[model samples]
Target: MAVSNVPKYHIAMFPWFAMGHMTPLLHLANEIAKRGHTITYFMPRKAQLKLQHLNLYPDLITFHTITIPHIDGLPPGTEIATEIPISLCPLLVETSDLTQDQIELAFRANKPNFVVHDNAHWMPRLAKQLGIKSICYDVVSAATLALVFVPGRNFPKDRPITEEDLSQLPPGYPSSKVVFRGHEIRPLMMITMPMGKNITFYERMVKAKKDSDAIAIRTCEELEGKLCEYMVAQYKKPVLFTGPVLSAEDMKTPLEDRWDKWLGGLNPGSVVYCSFGSEFILEKDQFEELVFGFEVTGLPFLIALKTPRGCATIEEALPEGFEERVKGRGVVYGGWVQQPLILKHPSVGCFVSHCGASSMWESLMSDCQIVLVPQLIDQVLNTRQLAEELEVAVEVKREENGWFTKESLSNAIKSVMDSDSEVGVKVKNNHAKWKEILGKPEFMSGYADRFVQNLHDLVK
Candidate 1:
């Protein structure tokens, strides 16, 4: 098919505030910009800072910051998209309340050839009223999307997870792991993380699914073809997997040099990388368990500690002399670090993660052995699939309080770093193959162009 010679389009790309969502959508916008489309990327100020740090300047892309009028109970500069809790519950409600107004006016004023918005955002409902095209962008995995949209067949819920439960995976895929459509999984889970419980938000998601023009997820069918089929069959929308939209163009400081330095200072494969992405807010007990686990693990690790000031109850959670004993051996930095770089580093042999889709993909693509430290939603399921099913990662044991203790954390870390361990060797080997598959140039850009072409067809 020949490329269209139509006039340039004004496109609005809106993503929910989390790093996982913002990073990929920005990549999509850059691709659209390269195609001569003018993009107005709408997000909050905090999100703007993150984008700016990535060198995505206003001159490069127009940024429309959402302004809330007469909103009480909101701190100043709180834009709903960026400020919503990491849990799907609050995010669904806050984004709906926050994006509804801006979405209405932005679509009306720009008369966009199409409005590309996050599935969590409010554009789907307003698209028809504003006489514009809109598409739901899933920032999570296609396998996850499949799990949510395709309802799980009735299985005896006698146990938390039985062999019968695992056998119901989408067809054409191995039934070794239980995978459901992404939409169907959200409502059933105990939603907790950045903010605790809100059941009403799930109800809104059901309605939003019915109102959208189309849906797209941040994945590739080549990577998850069977699951993608399930999503399309269930949603009855054109669900395109656009692959991971990570620009390979000088993302940050090269990891090789940093890894060499970190290795020169330590033994080979000695350092562990611990990060939970930006969404998890650890409670005091949970924080203590992690720190205690690190102390017990007796391995050099780089941990990102993002506990808010009040959440400094982590000090109380740690074992006595925990920080002092690990001085210079274990490094802990507050706020964010470049995770992909950390994972790709040679010194870092293992990742203890929350299993967010982006981090999971990055870990796989970077050849980093993983130890799953899942918190909520599809993470526990993903952990099971990666560890128990794929044998590419290890799952940390959890307690009844829903937090994995320091003992389990330490043991998992030690096991992964143990060169003699069969599981460790298996993970290392599997990661190499994952990296090889993800490194294919066609996997990145070729599929992306196909996705954009699909969007162009709908608009034209």
Candidate 2:
């Protein structure tokens, strides 16, 4: 078809008000705009500012900021997930839901050909009333969606979701291999917890998914086809995939000299780099165990983390005389470090990650030997996909109480770091093989093309 013959789309997106949700949606927006479609992205004032730098095709992707209404529990002016503690997120959700009228007004004015959203269960029905096709986008791991949070997962009678229940698999679940352990069920178990006066988290998710015109996920069909297919079967809806949708700007950006000069001085493939995502603030005990675990490895290490609870800083949380003992070889900083560039460093041979969906893809595409220490439910299932299904990473074993000791964490890292160990060599080669395939431009771009096509199909 000629340029004039192509049907140009104007799409509206209203992602959940979290950094994790917003970032991937922006990446998808970039992909859509690259193909000459127009996007009207709706977000809170603070969030729109944060994502401004990432909007590669500014001419095509226009942002429309909406006011976050005041809620009693939410601090004044709290607009996004980063501004408040995780416990206060439900309040944030309530605050954001107050913007539905503003959003509906924009939809009526812009008259976008389609709309995309997640979490906000009311979005699909609103899209219908406004005559816009709605797509429920899953930006997390496909395995996480398929295994744990499948709609209609049963509980005995009207009882609450427990760790014991989570240990058991839901019927027709695609993969039994992605099972959750006792300690790893908290994130999932929270689904039954109320997110609103009238709605539970699981109910919100089921409504968003079931009511949407189509289900879209940030994954490659090649990588997670079975899981994506399982979603189609479970929801009885068309499931479209968007590959990893990693930021192009991130790949183009260089590692800062602060890290580059330091990491360069070390031997190749000798350092252990560990980082959980920004949201998880550890308990002081667990924080110390993590630092000690890296310390006992005797390898150079970098740990980027938020200050643990009850401690003012990482320094205060350290074990006695710990800084002096490992002075030159280790550093624990509470600031943000560029993970993708850090993983690409020559000295960084192993990655101990929490396996958040974005981090999971970054680790897979890097040369580092993968080691997982999953805390949340999504991270746990992502770990299983990499460790069990893909055989590309090693997961640290937690105790019966759902906590890991320094010894267990140390052993998990060493198993994949030591060349003589069978597990080390196995994961190394597997990681490299996966890296080659996922790193290819064609493989990543193909999914984006198909995703946009699906959008066209739905609207037509």
Candidate 3:
């Protein structure tokens, strides 16, 4: 706390109000704090509560709460921490001026040398008003940005992903999934390319690509070189391929004694860990597919179901005889799971995920084979890239509806478990590489240092 001992280079981080966004930014902030810089993370108070709920290391960084004005259009009681639909996200932008004012006041009071802003935030405008250098923090990979944005000759004259092109690979695209859960194909990819479309998300990305001082991506060149190159050429900004930002303790081994007690009678690898993140509830038909899938997969499954439909509750969501059929093997929780710990368990050999970047990172970090089941937004694209390009994961189904029959689900799990299969080996290798990449304490520290130094330079 001494004046000289305080060191230099104060930075501010503002991320989208999603757990995926907050997790990495918090990890980065903690890293910067360790390097003797001050970081005041700006976010809604509810987000701060979520961090506290997770028992995050609060002593390492400071939280500057920004009260979100209640917008008329948003549904009642929708906390800022919950997911806002893409259609509603634009309202946040319209209200950007007000958020900007709050941010500027915080800036005037704290005078951050630089600010790292989420891709969705009205960052460039906010930074210009504050006269502080701003960096775009992309929570997803750069390759994804490029693939989504980079226009192709086949691209429609107008529209977002004009035609069905889900099966079509990127130019010199790496090995990505051709099919998922039976013969279902991704219908969303057939639309116009993601970048050229004037949708709010695309416009924000374009603005950030054209005007941001620098862009930081949550991926490494080692894992994705071609995608990184595409981003560099298209964005025309200094691309900082900041490695995946994650904390070691994220994999808190639930007390060995407690975990053992919890699983006292179950066979090892008997429990299926099902979580669809804080958001993303299943529709009725989709929920039924899930019910049958778990039954057909013939594995002991634990499902956490949530949705806008009344199905979010367990008894309401579970089909008749679902519990009776699965019996002791089935445990349904209505809310979130400790994902990091669940993925790391010896019983957890496979992860059914929406392939959000955080979930993907956590699953790979845990060295588990993943069955990707992306629901909305960039997830379909991410799932495609992970399964096809990376070859480490498998897609649950190609349809955007997230509709997979019980038979497909059973086969997907079987394929994932067939230890001798090529895909399975590649998955294991990819998981091993991920473990090697992130498991190194020194390597993680280096990323922390580079991120801090880069921000310091931006401020200077």
Candidate 4:
């Protein structure tokens, strides 16, 4: 690369230890590197291994591993948070805090202009000690962050959040109403406000917000313009929106692969690609119901499910003869697959998702209609935005008490897949509109450029 008038920077990134968190940070790091900056990414050893397939720029991006110090209650070899149950997340946070000394040592040896960290509370304080500017990079939606970080809106500091608290609107955000049901918020509170921890997840988020010089979120104004505007007013900080950060390179997979071959052979707009991400572990009964729902649809479908802990294979968890019953029409994969590639396939018309922010963006870019079946934290919030606000997805209606039935699942799938239906037509049109916006290079790259320019100003 030739020298230019633009100033180059050395930035360090530290994201929470999960694939969902690490992948976005990696994409942002690549974006920054493309502008001729140097990045030193800090991650746990096991998490770093997952990036082996990514075609990162070696000259500009460096991976530095932080050895995870073991906690007593955490299981052996569980270096990453997703490897264990959500109940153990608080211990994972505590273990991440133990890496403070190691991270500080790395900073002292090679100082950078700025450090970017995620929801970890200790990072801003550490960056302050090193006299480097700190930027909080949030991977979740802006609406979720607005509820958590805005002053006086968070849960009471002294007590855990209750069902009543979850139902009401957060303080200071009167215009933003509560959209999550009590059942949806129950699991979210369990993950974020775990018992016996000295610091609650909400408190950690508050600290990170209060200590950072500025904030960077992985979204665009197009999707969450109102909430982003509200967050800027509430926090009184420089809020930068890095729109999507998607690339074709990240979605690449061998076309000749079995999964690709099967998808390619199907008719366009005929298949539903279902995945619940890596962290969600479904109960046997719940898993069976989902499989049966897909079988009832009788449409060509592909599902990628995470193997539950102690389950030797997908077969052990699956209903007897379920695969045989759906043979030639549906295929189930136990482990990971190239999700982006599948979504981009012409045969895939709908994405049956857990409503994760990443999956939402991928579906939008691929012009695939969404069928939301949210499982855990922030997913419910994402579902609300897509199904209610954006009107680009149809959520599966659960029982009055929040339990899902196979009938409801099948109905939701059919609603989105039926092109002649009113809901299906609207969803397809909305998805296409967003896809056109996301396809433009200038629209997405503009956000990254603004982010880097703002960081340059902050450091100067």
CA lDDT scores, all candidates in order: 0.65, 0.86, 0.67, 0.80
Number of the candidate with higher TM-score, 1 or 2: 2
Q: Residue 178 in model 1: shift from native, Å?
A: 3.1
The per-prediction tally of clashing pairs is 14, 0, 13, 0
Scored by lDDT, the top model is 2
What TM-score do all the candidates reach, one by one? 0.83, 0.96, 0.85, 0.94
Please, what are the lDDT tens digits per residue for candidate 4 over residues 1-460? 2223458989999998888888988889988898899999998989888885563787898999998888799997677877898778778878888888998999998798789998777788888888989998998888777755566654654655555665566645533432566354457565346433587676778678778999889999888777788787877888888888776585555544887788878899899889998888877677888888898998999989987556778889888898789888898888788888888778888899998879878877876879998876577778878887777889898876555888999999898888688999998887777788878878877888878888877866
lDDT computed for candidate 1? 0.65
Local error of candidate 3 at residue 314 (angstroms)? 2.0
Off by over 4 Å in 3: 1-7, 53-60, 81-87, 92-97, 150-160, 163-199, 252-260, 398-402, 420-426
1-460 in candidate 2: lDDT tens per residue?
3333448899999998888889999999998888889999999889887889999999999999998888798888889887777888878877777888999999999999888897678898899998899999988888878876678777553665666777777767778888776564456556777676578777777888999999898888778898888888999989999899887688688898889998998999999999888688888989999999999999999999999999887889999999999988898999889898899899999999999988998898899999998888888888988999889999998898788999999999999989999999988888888889998878877877778888877866
Better of 2 and 3 by TM-score: 2
Q: Ten residues in a row with the worst lDDT in model 1? A: 190-199
For candidate 1, the TM-score is: 0.83
2 or 4, greater by lDDT: 2
Ranking by lDDT: 2, 4, 3, 1
Candidate 1 lDDT at 116 equals: 76
Worst 10 residues of 3 by lDDT: 178-187
**Candidate 3 C-alpha lDDT tens digits along 1-460:** 3322334777888887767778788887776676667778887777787785443446646888887766677665444545564445455544433576788788888877778888644667767777878888888765556655443324443554532444444565443442222333333343332321244445556666567788888877667666777666766667776677777666554534544455556666656666777766666777778768877777776676665365546677778877788787766667566677767667767788888888877776776777877765456667766787667787764344447777777677667767787877778787687678767777777766666666655655
